[model samples]
Target: MARRMVIIGGGAAGIGAAGAAKAAAPSAEVIVYTAFEDVGYSPCGIPYVHGKEIPDFTSLFLAEKQAYADAGIDVRYETTVLGFDPESRTVQVEGEGPSGYDALIIATGFDYKPPGVPGEDLGGLYYVKNIRRAMEWDKILDNVRHAVVVEASPLGLEMVTALAHRGIDTHVIDPHPWALGELCDPDIVAPVQESWAEMGVTTHWDTRLLGFTGDREGHVRTVATTDGELPAELVVVATHKVANNALAVAAGLRTGSTGGLVVDDHMRTSAPHVWAAGDVCEIPHGVGGLPLQGLTGSHAYAQGKVAGTNAAGGERAYQPVYVPWGMVAGTWMIGGAALGEVAATALGVPHVVGKATGISRARYFPGVRPVTVKLLAEPRTLRLIGAQMVGGEGIKERADFLALAVRKGITLHDLASMENVYSPPIGALNEPIVTAAQAGVST
Candidate 1:
């Protein structure tokens, strides 16, 4: 009998899993089910689209339905999987009926979460996470002269930049003093705030949104926050998302502390033949073994591969999750892990931070952007635990090196002694990582 593989969700994770499963067992019948019209589109690019960096909404997609069919995989679009019976190994799809499966892969990612405040259901409120934002937001986005964005995540700042670029009076509000709160340290944050001010982005630090008020037409007009009320035409909320785990919870799968499905390295759930991936599952943190949500697109695809491969009778394990991320907002660019003094204090780890700035190119070379590097190390062992930076470019790549160092438990001395490839047109001869490493060791 041919094995049957059923995948729920058509996001990056689900798509990656589907491909891997088919490759692992060509004779197996593979099916991918999603409730969305478009499949394999990048969610991370939504902010860029809203910012007008992307040319069109259609450009975000990776493949079309024909491509999936040509590969001998079944893609059931606009299909919602409501429930599954583990005993019968069957899944019930909306309007399509129930189907039996030998193995099940659940990649139903994050849900659209609202900022738990009053009057959130009002009109003119937009969410960057929703797919409809890309397909339909254009009709109303033109009228948004003044936009109030409520969020604490780094993506919120991205939205602030996108909205500000559209010549809208953009105001970003959060209860925290700095944006990218846990990711970037104060050293990187200071320059960011100054840049935000220069970009005409009003920052409402240490303020929380209490409620929202609208005009007679029921369109959101006034932003009533803890600080005060401000006039607004539109409100965009880009807050953190909760995992979509209703199916897993109903199916009696064990959930981790991260509020996502608990899975081993192979991404297998508590059930005998069930697997979960993407934001709906939790992976271990690189620094500490604590299970944390792997919310990035890169993570979703990679983890999905592991889950799918294993479910298809192949052995593959997911890797430790670390974010080698960068964001360009307006004229400001930020890179690195953003875990420095604050993270160490919160985690109760005795740590020291070393900071240094190196030019992106030689002094004589043109386009010499300043790259800042902050290295966090254990005071006792001098092991690199985290790093943060703010630079024009070529910084996040350097942060990836540090991320590897953190993964390998590399010592500061080891990093400082490593040879840094430097060219006059690219960066300083010394390299910021080695400089930061030396500084961290001395501290």
Candidate 2:
């Protein structure tokens, strides 16, 4: 009998795992089980489609079912895996009988974090976790006049902008002191916050949702927030997500402290012939090897490759995660990597901060954009631990450089001394990083 590989979930991670496993072991039969209808589509683009940035909902889909078939992979849609038998190396599906596999991969993804309050099950309550749920928003947005989003992450801001663009009188309620509180520092987010009113969005900071009231039809009508009641026709819970570890936990696999599957560096679970990856995973971060979740498609895809390769009788180690994430909010861009001051402090590290503000291009250049750079360092060793940037067109490349620097433990002075290119039409004469590092050195 040929080797058989079964993968759970059909998101980016599962799809990548299917393809990689097939490629690594050509003779093996690869099967992917997904509860969702679509696979390999970008979840990050869900907001853009809702905001009408994209033409239609179908545009977000990556490929059709035939595409997977052509690649010699079987994708089972709307199929739920109920149980796993480690001794038999098989999985129990909803309708189908036990499917034997030589190896199993669990890329079960994540579920939306819901507000712990009553009436959340009401008709108007929605969530923006995956593209499938986002599609429902486009269909139902026509009837919504007032929409309230609960949370203040990048996705929350994006949903706020989308609802505002639709003239829905959007209001955002966040427990954080400021907007995009997790990604950018308050100083970097000030200008963006000030522009909320102009964009027709209301900002409610340091506020929590108490509960919700529904009409006779059980549709959310009034939102009960800490400050006061707001008339709301629609409510979106655009908050963080927890791992989708139902199948993993049921299979008696070990879980991490962070509530993700405890996988080895190669993405192997404790169960025999089983591997796990994607948003359902906890990965190593920094030199400390601390387990953290970097909820980006890039991270999922990379981890899936390792899981698939190893499941197919190949050896591949997962690299230490230097997660680089960013978002474009209105006209401003925010990005970060590794340990920020908040994370470092929680980790009990003695840390210092460095900050610099400059223009993206030469002072005299046309279309010069404002840039802010902040670096976090270990005071004793002077090692760059984290970098955050809020600025214009050029912030991403600079953030990427700093991410690598943090990964390699480069010192602030070393970065300042490194050679950089500058041009009148291209970039600033003095790199923003040099100034930020110089600021770090001064501390």
Candidate 3:
């Protein structure tokens, strides 16, 4: 008899696992259970849908129902897996009905936590994490003239940008001194702040949202921050994310110190014949193997592949999870190691870095905007450790090269001597990567 492989959560990781498992064991039965109505929609595109960047909400679907069926993988939508039994190797799924599985893969992903401040449960308050929430907010956009966004992380910034594009009076409030505090340093952050300001997005820095005020109808009217109160027709809380690991915990699987399911290199959880992926799994830190770092789609997809392959009687080892390099808004692109302050301080690298705010292509190039690049290296070791870049165009690709350099432990001298294709219309004679490395070496 063919083995039965059950995968939970139809996000990036779950879908990838289902596909890989079917390929590895052609005779095996692969079934994916998703709580959402849609199976393979892109979570990252939620902001774009809100901004109308995507023409329609359905455009974010990565795969259609027929696509999964074509692969011979059974997809059960609107089915929530409540818990699992390790001894029986079965999962308790709720929605249409309860079901059982021989082997299970958990990839439930994460959810945003609205700030616990008063009036948070008001009608106008929102947090966009999935397609349903995005669609709901899309309708609310027509009624909202002003919106206040709490938190300025990537998701928060994206939502604020989308609101501003819709001509809504948008304000972003964050306790951090600058936006993307975890990704970029102060030098790189300044240009992004300036860009947001130029776009007419008001910012409240170094302040916390204390509470909210409501109108006579009990709808949120204004946001009360530590600084003051601001009028808002809608309030969005985008503070932080928590993994959906209740099923894994209920199955008697070991959880990480930070609350995610603890999995080994093979994506195997503490329970036998069970695995976890995506946001529910606490992947190892690239630098120090630390736990609790955020999980991205790329990491989830890779982990799922490993879990699926191994579950089909194949041997595969997943590599260490690293920080992702990708684009966000059209103008601003960030790429770097998402290292903790603890790691930075432990390295104790006294490196001198130079930054330049210039055009992406050339000053004469059309549609070019100001791009900033910051490089970090240890002068004594000459090893390039970190770099951050932000710009309107061509910054993301360049940052990828820098991230590669850091991952390979490339020295400043090596990067200085590296060759790069360049043209006045396309790129600089000395690329930002080379220039930044040379600057680090000189210092």
Per-prediction TM-score to the true structure, in the order listed: 0.96, 0.95, 0.93
Task: Name the weakest run of 10 consecutive residues (lDDT summed) in model 2.
Answer: 286-295
Task: Summarize candidate 1's per-residue lDDT along 211-259 as a digit string, tens digits.
Answer: 8888788889989988888788888887776789999899888898878
lDDT of 1 at 300: 91
lDDT of 2 by residue, 333-357 (tens): 7777776666677678788888899
lDDT of 3 by residue, 344-374 (tens): 6555635656455556676676876666666
Per-prediction count of colliding residue pairs?
Answer: 2, 0, 0
Off by over 4 Å in 1: 130-132
Model 3: CA > 4 A from native: 95-99, 329-331, 338-343, 346-359
Model 1 weakest lDDT span, ten residues long: 130-139
What C-alpha lDDT, on a 0 to 100 scale, does residue 398 get in candidate 1? Answer: 77
lDDT of each: 0.82, 0.83, 0.76
In model 3, pairs of residues that clash are none
| Candidate 1 accuracy as TM-score | 0.96
lDDT of 1 at 243: 86
Number of the top lDDT candidate = 2
